[model samples]
Target: MRIGFVGGGKVATAFGRYLHAHGLAVSNYYDRHEDKLSHACRLTGAHPCQSAAEVAKMSDMVLITTRDDQIEGVCRDLADHGVIRKDHLVGHMSGAHPSLILHDAARQGAAIFSLHPLQAFAEEEKALADLPGTYFSIEGTDPRLASVEEIMAKTGNRFFRLLPEHKRLYHLSACIFSNYLVTLMACGLEALSHSGIHPEDGFPAMMPLIQGTIDNIARLGPPKSLTGPIARGDVTTIEAHLTAMADPSLASLRQFYAFMGLKTLDLAIEDVLQDPLKANALKKVLEMG
Candidate 1:
């Protein structure tokens, strides 16, 4: 398939290069910025197009890799130029915007979809290297999304489909998994700092435990992987945590602990332990505090 990208930013450049590496036909990239267009072309080895329509006209599948807000505009440009052919695939890489946003492209007989790679695009080279290991979420308005699936299969990446209505749920889950994980890490670092451990030093110190937990989750799944005082139904240890977090300075972290503890308590109850009586007791402690 001849695939073109409508934006020349880091995502487009990285994805274009990754496709080219996988022996796919990568066509032109068009952006309003000449330097960005040139940079993308130089990295991806795709020729630069003069307009979004030009890119669409030359490709069977056009990926609109612009900022989330600019995607609809780019699709409208292609539609206005009458460039998209029947059965052509038009998709965006935005996790936040559903495929429904590309209404203009769909009106022009294109199969509109969002093909979100669930990974952050930080460094272009690293992004390209990480593509094969990433999972993708696809949501589309049309039934002709087999082409999208086929492309993902060709890349040997696992992918799943989401209903357009459920797209926001999927995006929010990703935000929690990736973005909120960082916020949670900061919370941990701050709590450690109260014990006189400098945050910079404490963060690195916690890496092994954090990484080990991640590896455990990956291998044994969340339920079986879980271990801690909550899993053991050690109410006294949790009470000590409550005591430590009672300080005015640690009020937010205290709340954070309770919220997270409640969730973890549920996991513990459902796991092999399956001790709801203990879970109920832990729940009471968290709520009462």
Candidate 2:
């Protein structure tokens, strides 16, 4: 299907380029940023449109890749211009918002859809090339959804449905996995820094181990996938971690350690071979913070 992109920003540009690469026509590109529009056109070999209406005028599918706050304005503009029609398929890449956010498009007779990639987009070029392997959260009604999923599958990405009402929860789960994993790594780096390890040297040192843990999680499943101090129920080791980081310089680290330990105790109760006394002791220590 011919796809028209309504924003030349990172997600729109990358996704447009990917569709083009897969022999799909990224028929038109539009953006407020002239440079981004030019760049998108350059990369996708697509024509640049002066406005969203110009884009909608030429394509069967329209992807609104604007910022979360801007989606409504863009849709309103499309509605005002009478640019959308029943034959069009409208989608957005936002995760926090559900497909219902595009109600203006729906009112204009377009089929509404939402597709959110479960990966970060640090660079446009890299995102475009890597998107084919990413997982996407998709939600819509019936044959439109089925068709979109088929197209997504052709890009070598996995697509799964989410109920509109559950979109926030689904997106929050990804945020914990992707965003909080970065936070977890930063904490690890800080703890290592207390031992005189530079952040620069620390990341490379931890990279293999971190990647291996992730691979193991993929292979072994959660709970069973867990390892280290908490998994082993090594209270002494965990205590040492807390005690070592109790100084003022590591106040945040101490707090986080306590919070994670509390959560870990819960995991241990579910997954570990635990003595009642030992579990109660671990719970007490973690709760003391």
Candidate 3:
């Protein structure tokens, strides 16, 4: 099938280049930003289009790769232009949105869907390299969902289907895994600063530990990989941590640590073998802050 793009940004450009590599027809790149359109067209070997409606008119499928906030409005614009055919497929790459966000296109008799890659898209070059191992989550009309699966399969990607009702939960986990992980790392940097360690020295020092944890998690999963104070129910060690962060300026950091510890404590109790009394005592220590 000929795939066209409505917004030639990172996702659009990456997918176009990735798909084109897999022997699929990719063309009709479109974006309000002329540079983006040219960039996508250059990388994908696609023809740049004058307008979004022109892209929809020219391809069998139109992927709206704009920001999440703009996807529904872009679909409405295509619908208003009355260009999408009854058999054409319309989709967006927003992880948080349900396929129903494309109702405007669906109203015009096009099949609409959502396709999200479970990876970060920082650079087109990196995205292309990452796409091969990336999994996709798809949701849409059941009959039309097969097309998405076909694309996943043809591009050597594995994917799972999701119900619209579960999309928010799935996306929320992604937000925590990606965005909140970065926040947690920043918190570690702050902790180092209190001890007079420069962020430059601290960040590099933490890299190996961060990578080791990731490796452990990949092999044993989070619950089984956990090995910190909470996992061992080491109440005295945990108490020392809390006491050290008692300064007024460190209140926020202390609170964050306590909050995360309580959550981690639950995981430790459920998944790790530990003395019941020690676990209870550790819980109390974490709760005290």
Candidate 4:
């Protein structure tokens, strides 16, 4: 199917480039930013459309990869242009929004879908390289499911259907897994800075351990992969950590440690190899902190 892109941002460029590379037709692209639209068209070998209406007119399907807040406005604009119709399929790439955001286009008789790739797109080139193994969360009418599947297949990706009501929770989980991990890493680097290790030096040093932990998680899963003071049921070590974090400068970290310690203690209790009594003692220490 011929595809057009509404917003020529990183995600639009990534998807368009991948689709083009995989032999899909990317017919046109449009964005408020002329440079980005021109770049995306160049990257995808698509015609540069002057307006969203032109994009809709030229393609069988349109991908609205605008920022989340702009999605509804873009859809409304497309509807106002009188371009969306029964023969067209439209979708957006916002993880936080469901297909319902495209109600304006649907009302105009287009099949609307939310097709979110469950991967971070920090940069266009990296995103294009990383797109193949990505998993997409799809939600929409059954009539358009096959088109979505075909796109996923051509991109060498997998997808699962989501209920409209579940979209927010799914996006929340994604935020925790992806965005919060970066926050957590920043917290780790900050803690290291307290020990006189600069962030640049500390980050690279911590990567191996971080990678190993991720590898363990991939191999064995959460509770089974956990290994640390709490996992070992070392109440004294946990108590020491809490005490160290109690300084005014580290107060927030103290709470963070305590919360994570409590969770770790739960995992330790579930571990067949851990002593439940020691795990309970760790929990008591965390609670006391």
Pairs clashing within candidate 2: none
How many clashes does the backbone of model 2 have? Answer: 0
Question: What would the per-residue lDDT of candidate 4 be over residues 1-289, giving only the tens digit for each residue?
Answer: 8899989999999989998999999999998899998899888899999888899999999989888999999999989989898888998999999989989998988888899999989898998888888899988865766888888877778898988889999999999999989989988988899889999999999999999999988999887888877777777887887777778989888788788778767776776336768867877888887
Candidate 1 structure quality by residue, lDDT tens digits, 159-184: 98999999999999999999999999
Off by over 4 Å in 3: none
Error of 2 at 143 (Å): 3.6
lDDT of 3 by residue, 1-289 (tens): 8899989888889889899999889968889999998999988889999998999989998999988999999899889999988998999899999989999888888888889999999987898899999999988864876887888889989997888888889999999999999999999999999999999999998899999999999999888988978888788899999999989999999999999999998888778846899988987888888
RMSD of each: 1.8, 1.5, 1.3, 1.5
Off by over 4 Å in 2: none
lDDT of each: 0.88, 0.85, 0.89, 0.87
Candidate number of the best lDDT:
3
Candidate 2's residue-wise lDDT over 78-160, tens digit each? Answer: 97899898888888899888888889999988888899998788898788768867889898773666768878867878878
Give the Cα error of residue 190 in candidate 1, in Å.
0.7
Q: lDDT, candidate 4, residue 15? A: 86
Query: Candidate 2: worst 10 consecutive residues by lDDT?
Result: 267-276
TM-score of each: 0.93, 0.95, 0.96, 0.95
